[model samples]
Structure formats: structure tokens, C-alpha cells
Target: MKSQIRVVWALMWSRAAVLRSDPERGEITTTVIVTALMAIAAIAIIGIIVAKLTQKANSIDLG
Candidate 1:
């Protein structure tokens, strides 16, 4: 997980550097693709967390 986070950070930093160095390079397509991928990953992570929480809540022995 830590490595995955680091990799993402690195990719974002590199993308930002490219845009910073060449503002008129027209990297919009790349930017859009990366943003969509990140959004999807965030949704998936949230879903997993919600599912785990729901499962644990259901297993509680509260009377």
C-alpha cells in the first residue's frame, strides 16, 4: 500500500512537471485519462471499506 501510494505520487508529480515545463504541449488527453483512473480507484477503495464495515457491523452480538 505504501509503495502504491508512492508510485501514484510520483506519477502525479511527473505529470505536473511535464505541464509546467510545456504549458502548450496539449497534454489534455493524458491528464483526463489519469484523472478518470484516479477517480475510479477512489470509488473502488471506498466501496471496499464500506463493505468491510457493513460485514463487521452485521456480525456484532449486540442484544
Candidate 2:
């Protein structure tokens, strides 16, 4: 079991070394501003939906 674990670890390290050595960033990366805007929009939509649902449920007066 220990030898199997060591072999897996060595393979992972080797792959990482290759990826690090040949670093390449193509033109498909979104900027920080776009990412932040999308996140905020998603959060706002979720918040509004949850708030409206809660308000509706509260108005029902379920006892």
C-alpha cells in the first residue's frame, strides 16, 4: 500500500513539473472585472429570488 501511494505521488509531481515548465496562456481567459461582474449579477439574482419567496411565505400566515 505504501509503495502504491509513493508511485502515485511521483507521477503527480512529474506531471506538475511538465506543466510548469511549458506554461502557456491563450486568449480565452476572462479579466478580473468580467469575473467579478458576473459573480455579482448571479448573487443579486439569487438574493432577489430568495427574498421574494420568503416574503410570500411570510405573508401566508401559516399556523
Which candidate number has the best TM-score? Answer: 1
Give the winner by lDDT. 1
Instruction: Give residue 3's error in model 2 in angstroms.
Output: 52
> Per-residue CA lDDT of candidate 1, range 1-63, in tens?
999999999999999998789966767888999999999999999999999999999999999
The C-alpha stretches of model 1 lying farther than 4 A from their native spots are 1-25
True lDDT of residue 56, candidate 1: 98
Error of 1 at 24 (Å): 3.9
lDDT of 2 by residue, 1-63 (tens): 999999999999999898777756332355766888999999999999999999998899667
Write out the backbone clash pairs for model 1: none
